[model samples]
Target chain A: MAARHTRNIVDRPIWKSKGEASTVSFSAFAFLFSELIQYSQTKVKSTAELENRLEVAGGEIGRRLLELLTYREKAPKRKTRLLDLLKFVHTTVWPYMFGKTADSLEQANAADDEYMISDVNLALTKYISVPRDMGSFNPGALAAGIVKGILDAAGFPARVSTHYVDVPGLSKPQTTILMKFEPSVMQREARLEPRAT
Target chain B: MALIYSLYIINKSGGLIFHKDFAPISRVDLNDSLRLASIWHSLNAISVQLSPVPSCTGIELLEAETFNLHSFQSVTGTKFVLVVDPRASSVPAFLQRVYQLYTDYVLKNPFYEVEMPIRCELFDAHIEAAVQKYPMMS
Candidate 1:
């Protein structure tokens, strides 16, 4: 049997005319994310494995988002410098994904290659409750993967890990993503730095 | 005046990962489509070598007698090819949207393995719905 011939199936543009106006409800997102975590849990034998799977998923998203965001904002091309790229992720990428910028961005004192992005409440995990026996399960590993993905695409090779940090007065646990740049990135940055007169 | 007839998504290794026809036309044999993809990939690489610039972004358009074929390649080496009416001006914009959908539906699908033939129902639905809005050229 012949398929029905439909008209105008390929004429319209993909995005709406009003850019940045499209939005998805947070509840819907949270529900889907929770399901994703649950599904990953079923496939993994360890909490770390589940977290790794989640991180990989997040990294995929981060890579695509970085490209789309850069294409949408074309006045200035994407950031090339390490600090500028990190700042872009903190100020632009975080807000676009979670509705707000990360709480803080800091450099580790002991390591020149290390940088941190801290959030008071990690959005993906806020509604998720890990079992008591699941040791060191940090859902924010997804966010870490996201950061790593973004940086990696921008030519920065780095390792990213999510950690839970407790503050004296804060009611919610703060999540911190630590990114450690590879030696090659550091060497490239040193070579590109302007020499002191 | 403007219409898209078909779309083809080719992976980095010259594999035809996805193909969809929006308008009624002669059926394309699967083996022929695969051969065309690899040949096009080779041509794209040769074009890059012949380019004056350090990086060649690959072929963006091919003007044929009855139709036009527009293509866009992502940094990750995935190529999007759209066969459309000759007058179509939204080729770049449409290709960008297709790439976004590819990332969201195909790349994000837990069941989908990388560089494999695309089998995501959601991706197919999204593409079909998206194409339905365009009017066919009579």
Candidate 2:
């Protein structure tokens, strides 16, 4: 039995390691992600379209990751509330995907439904230096898509967009993921809030 | 002896995205496989509608004399149908791995489009390897 167990452990694939956090090298991911963006560029006519393509691709990853990560969690619980879902993305999802938590999570004063999650140096955008002609083209759109995928899959439908926000004292602008929940999501949240307590 | 017969992948809208025959016995032409996928898609939907319980997932396993069909559907409605020997073990685990491969190679491929026929060479190679790794009872 001991010999069989040892053989099993030795033969097991690296990715099949149970309960351990598996990660690919940043350089590997950076190369693949940059290639993804460049490929999207060739397919699309405009920068917006390229970003859209990247987001769609990231959404696919996010959707799968939601299931995989949640299953990996010790006590897997679905986040029904909007705030809980957002916190999950900020704290749990961000660190799992990007190796660090987001800088800030804030509700916009201008709108009740709008919220923003900002990262000082987004891993996806770290090596990416956007050309001047592609003005305001943030590769962070992929990250936005991931957030959208998580939220949408969790039953909190939201339109997530990426923006380059200039923060004082920071050398580079922060990548902010702006999430605007649908009216139905707000209504559901309100309905659930009264019942939770 | 080939324990697995074939594999079929159907998109959400009942379109045949991928089909592969592993063994020589169950070899199907492209048109036949496409039609088979659509027919199975309709049957799956009909099974759901006919179910008495709420949130009923469609037909999961179908047993025939010579072979058995195991179907797995993702949350996004993409269906994976595996045709294997009646005595095959660990089919679900194999299907799950195949789904993971699809996510890694097909969905992650920038050139690949959603809900389209999967033509990724990497996906094909990995799937072939996965099939070889699956343990089959003779």
Candidate 3:
């Protein structure tokens, strides 16, 4: 029986043979991201189109991340409360996947239905240098799109935008990824509001 | 706690692309960063000069405090320096992940500078996460 258990070079990962998979490599991701950028570039003739395409791409990522984060585990108690969820996204969920908490979380000005979480940098776009021929490409923006997409797909209904916010004295410039919630979100939160202590 | 000293990435041409101080190292002097970078730059050049072309030390690592400071050089001439805690197991894993992030977010981002210290938000965030997981790090 032991002799019959030969490891195939292609599927040598013991865990996977037992029906488990492994993590993806960055090289693979680079090719994928590069292709994604190329695909996004092909759809648009203007800067706005490119930006929108990047956002849509990010949104797709957000959608996947949301599902992966929420349902990937079996918790004794499910996440409840708007603040709880926001915190989860800001610190727990974001860091788990992307590697850090957002730089800031702010309430939208003159808007009761909106809130913003700003990330000084988004990693997925780290290596990419938008060529002069290409409109300025920002991966953080795409990441914001991803977040928004995930939140929206989860019925949270929010908009995310990644912007390059200049900071004084840094080797690499900083990025600000802003997430804005929709008005309906506020109303829904109000209805689901927990009782005051 | 064992603190990470700093990180540096040098090209095969002796160009210093990136250098970062992960933890504090006093008495090393403020300009020590640039100086050390320069020195390391020369050392790397000399290392390559001494070795046969294309046969030079590729991905060389140096350890300090056993699990603390380490330097890694890739064949592509990208070097990663780590000043990590003493008990962080799996140095290979740590470096591999760092390199992965470098290749993904840093290298992929159009705006990122090669051989220069990384200032990408994603890289910082990811490193923060990794450090947070280090038991010795707060």
The lDDT of each candidate is: 0.80, 0.84, 0.64
Compose the digit string of candidate 3's lDDT tens values, residues A82-121: 6766776787567666656877776768877566776555
Candidate 3 C-alpha error for residue A9, in Å: 15
Which docking band does candidate 2 fall into?
incorrect
In Å, residue A189's CA in model 3 sits off its true spot by 2.0
List pairs with backbone clashes in candidate 2: none
- Best-matching candidate per DockQ: 3
Interface RMSD of each: 10.4, 9.7, 4.8
Error of 3 at B100 (Å): 13
Rank by lDDT, highest first. Answer: 2, 1, 3
What are the candidates' individual DockQ scores?
0.01, 0.01, 0.22
Off by over 4 Å in 3: A1-23, A74-80, A131-137, A169-171, A194-197, B1-138
Interface RMSD of 3: 4.8
lDDT, residue A41, model 1: 70
Better structure of 1 and 2 per lDDT: 2
Angstrom error at residue B99, model 2: 41
Tens digits of per-residue lDDT, candidate 1, B1-138, equal 338888999999999999888877776889999998888888888888889988678788889998898889998999999998887667788888888878766665444567888886658877887787665556
Each model's Cα RMSD? 20.9, 19.5, 10.8
